[model samples]
Target: MKVCFVGSSGGHLMHLYMLKRFWADKERFWVTFDKEDARSLLGEEKMYSCYFPSNRNIKNLIKNTFVAAKVLKNEKPDVIISSGAAVAVPFFYIGKLLGAKLIYIEVFDRIDKSTLTGKLVYPITDKFIVQWEEQKTVYPKAINLGSIF
Candidate 1:
């Protein structure tokens, strides 16, 4: 199955990268920022660079949404998975609309409360996973799959 992995840079991307073994054997591509870490880690991988200043940036959000639409249209992945910050928001929404299964993993941080991306994508995601049991209280429908780290 074709998979589209979407996440922001830093910890969000790290969390997703931890699952390399899971997607290693699958046909996959990535949606992330064009940052140093992303470039270094995903050097040989297929990727689509998302816009920066994504969170709360209405302009970039709209721009990235359009870009995400094109990526989704071209990739046509069966599953779209993310450990988010902001970039995943547009991708998840557009992927769902395009009939792709959405899987969202709440980041390893934020044990106290749900993140904005988590709250927004919860209703639409086909599978919602949380690292902490406390997060399950915030996302009752989410499965506690332990830490991705």
Candidate 2:
């Protein structure tokens, strides 16, 4: 199976990296911003870099959509999994267009409420995994997969 992982730089990347255990037997690549954390975490793997836009900016979002479209066309993954903070938006959308299964894993930091990315992308996911059960009420379709830590 071919899997593509996407996320932003810090905690999102950390949460996604923990999923390495699940993809150990499959082929995988990554899409993330060029940051110290991403460089360190995904250095040994095939990674595609993109500009991580600020959550409040609209212009950057347009650019991200274009970048994501390119990545989706190029990688052609069977499935795309994300532990997100905004960057997951375009990737998952493009993954859907390519007929890939989309998996959204809510970050571990969100203990009480659902995050902006989690709420936005939840409906589009084939499987939604949350670390906190408290979030299940907000996103009832999500599965409690326990904490990534």
Candidate 3:
């Protein structure tokens, strides 16, 4: 199955990387920020860089939406997974619209409260995974996969 992994840099990307073993043998690519850390960690893996300043930038969000739509159309991945900040929003919606299974992993840092991105995409995600049990209260349908760390 072809998988598209999407997430921001830093903790979000790190947590998502922990799942590398699961997708190691599968056909996969990534959608993330273009940063030194992401570059070093991803190595030679296939990746597409999204626009920066995504969290609250309406202009870039709109730009990234189109980018996400195009990528979804071209890649046609069977599944799209993300541990997000804000960049994943467009992909989540577009991926689901394109019939790709959507999986959203709640970031590890937010145990007591739901993340903005999590709340926004929760309804559309096919699978919502949480690292901590407390997060289950926020995302009742979420599967507790323990910490991705």
Candidate 4:
């Protein structure tokens, strides 16, 4: 299956990368910041640079929505997965419209509180995985898969 891994750089990107066991055998591409860490980590991989400084930035959010529409439409992945810091929003929303299954893994650091990105995508995600059981209280339908670390 074709997979789209989307997230911001650093920890969010690392979280998705940790799932190599799942995406390793699948045809995959990435959507993330053009930062040094992401550039080094994803070198030689098919990747699309996304708008960044994405935290509560309405401008980049709108820009990324357009980016999401174009990239997701052309790549057309069967599934889109993320452990997010904000960049996942546009991709998940647009991917859902394009009939891709959406998966969101709540970040491992937030145990009791739900992330803004997790809350926003939960209603639409096909699979919502939590790294902590306490997170399930915040995301009642989320499956506690323990930490991805």
Residue pairs in clash, model 2 = none
Whole-model Cα lDDT of every candidate shown, in order: 0.92, 0.85, 0.93, 0.93
Query: Compared with the true structure, what per-residue lDDT tens digits does model 3 show for residues 1-149?
Result: 99999989888888888897899999999999999999999999999999987898899899999999999999999999999989999999999889999999998889988999999999999999999999999999999999887
Ranking by TM-score: 4, 1, 3, 2
Over 1-149, each residue of candidate 1 has an lDDT whose tens digit, in order, gives: 99999998888888888898999999999999999999998989999999987888999999999999999999999999998988999999999899999999998878979899998999999999998999988999999999876
Model 3 off-target regions past 4 Å? Answer: none
Which lDDT tens digits does candidate 4 get at residues 28-94? 9999999999999988889999998998999999999999999998999999999997889999999
lDDT of 2 by residue, 1-149 (tens): 89988888888888777777888788998888898888987778888887756475678777888988988898799999988878788888888988999999887777788888889899899999988889898899999989889
Clashes of each: 0, 0, 0, 0
Q: What is candidate 4's local distance difference test score?
A: 0.93
TM-score of model 1 (CA atoms): 0.98
TM-score-better candidate, 2 vs 3: 3
Better of 2 and 4 by lDDT: 4
Scored against the true structure, residue 11 in model 1 reaches a CA lDDT of 84
TM per prediction: 0.98, 0.94, 0.97, 0.98
Clashing pairs in 1: none
The candidate with the higher TM-score, 1 or 2, is 1
